[model samples]
Target: MSPTNNKKAMCRYAGAQNQNVQRTALPEIIDRIVNSLDDPECFAHIGEEPIHFSTSVREMIEKFRNILFPGYFSDAKIDSVNVSYHMGQEITRLYDILSRQIIHVLRHDCLRYDRECSECERRGNEAAFCVIEQIPVLRQKLAADVRAAYDGDPAAKSHDEIIFSYPGLYAITVHRIANILHQRSIPKLPRIMSELAHSLTGIDIHPGATIGERFVIDHGTGIVIGETSVIGDNVRIYQNVTIGALSLPKDAGEKLRWAKRHPTIEDDVIIYSGATVLGGDTVIGARSVVGGNVWLTRSIPADTKIFMEEPRLIIKNQPKETDSEGN
Candidate 1:
């Protein structure tokens, strides 16, 4: 087509349509969509607050990080002089946001049973205080994690480098904070905390996982620790490692919800990149090394090394094809 005709064709498609069609069709579409939500399968409720408010949860995590690592991941200026003052302020702010979120989760659970909870506010306060009390312990655990990362990785320069720039450290820190609330059986908020870390770092550690001190995830990404997983001290895991469930029980009752489904890693083990260790019965014993891309489903004794054999590769050059006439 000619340039003039193409421009004319484009101009013909550039204007607004009929007002009556949009005005009539939009409300009808909305009504159809909204009315459809009344079906039994659809889950829109008429009167209820959110199960968990994500904005509040995010704020709680932010303040938690700020407290866990002062002057790192925080907006406030910190020094030895005013450390106590800043810590108090950050904890107060975090408690306010977290308590409200705990209350929201409690109310949501009560809503499912069509009951109004009078104790939600009190319980929320108690839960928040429990987590607040764990801050010092979480810091202690996180310091071990930071030290592990700095000591394990040859590329690490300083403690400040590991604290400020490592994704693994950040995810582990989030998990430590979330694990405290998870252990307290405060519903919904723990998962939210872990998920926020998953969004930022590609590490998917369940809040229910029991991880010990001096843990390091080197160049961490695609690492999944299942809900019932247990990891012992001085363990180091590389990127793309999955310590997950082999199979979930079928037709199991609610009693089996918290049953162990993931593997256990003992102390001083090193899991290299792209390794998958599955099944709750499977254990990596102390001082073991699992090499890259190894798929394991069975337990190994202590002081073992697992690696794949070297595969042979052939080198070949592409042959240029001649034209149809053999030119």
Candidate 2:
């Protein structure tokens, strides 16, 4: 054979061997990944129907928002003439989504925790019904919150403006809904709802917190209300406020589960920006004013004003510059 033909034949043989190696390596890589799924802590739901987190759960939240604030969200035009009909459709849709998601979470929890089955389907439907029935009451409470926001913040033009534009109000609205499910002892769904709001609003309010009506959160960026915080009616809080537990150990989550690890704010209290009130025993009495940048770990009497002393201001004047022609 010619040298060129011999070289071509050798190249074709080498290429075929490389192709075989590539095909063999692909399955080995896949096998490694598949083997990792056998680990006890991998949490792989192999052969099980997976829970829908992003799609169905988020859509359910949107439906609740549409129902809670009629016409404020992306819903068909709602007016007094056809209000009942529109609400019926919205509630029906919300119930369908809510019940299904609840059942998924409940069933997943039962299987994961090795707990006995408790008729997740029936419980889910009942929970959905209870949440739907609370709509009227929730609306009334939200109205008070809107009114408080308008009355407290001079920048608010109208209730409509707050409903449409305010991130604080939106966060509070979602918290109210999630808190209901949290109170009812539903599994997983409440935290998902609250985390969704936290992601969007930068306001991390745990659904387990008990907040009252006429609550107002102004410039609500960086607000963190812990799980056991008890906020009273007519309370107003500003940005960067932390109503949370003190520092905890690594095992605190297990030890402090169901324990009151946050402060209590009595009615008509105002917590200003950058304030940190820590410890479960800490309480801010009724009508107390917590000034900005103040850190408190103790209980205060009613109508008290807690403020950090004015930061010392030192204004140093700069000497005037001289021209090259020495002025």
What's the lDDT for residue 184 in model 1?
Answer: 82
Cα RMSD of predicted structure 2: 5.3
Best by lDDT: 2
Off by over 4 Å in 2: 1-27
- Write one digit per residue (lDDT tens) for candidate 1, span 100-156: 888888888887767867488899999899989888888899998998898878899
Residue by residue across 1-327, what tens digits does model 2's lDDT show? Answer: 999999999999999999999998998899999999999887787655477676676788788778878888864777899998988888899999988888888888887777898799999999989998999999999999999999999999999999988989988988999998998899889998888889989999999999999999999999999999999999999999999999999989789897999999999999999999999999999999999999999999999999999999999999999999988
**Reference-based lDDT, residue 200, model 1:** 92
**Candidate 2 clashing pairs?**
none
Alpha-carbon local distance difference test for all models: 0.88, 0.91
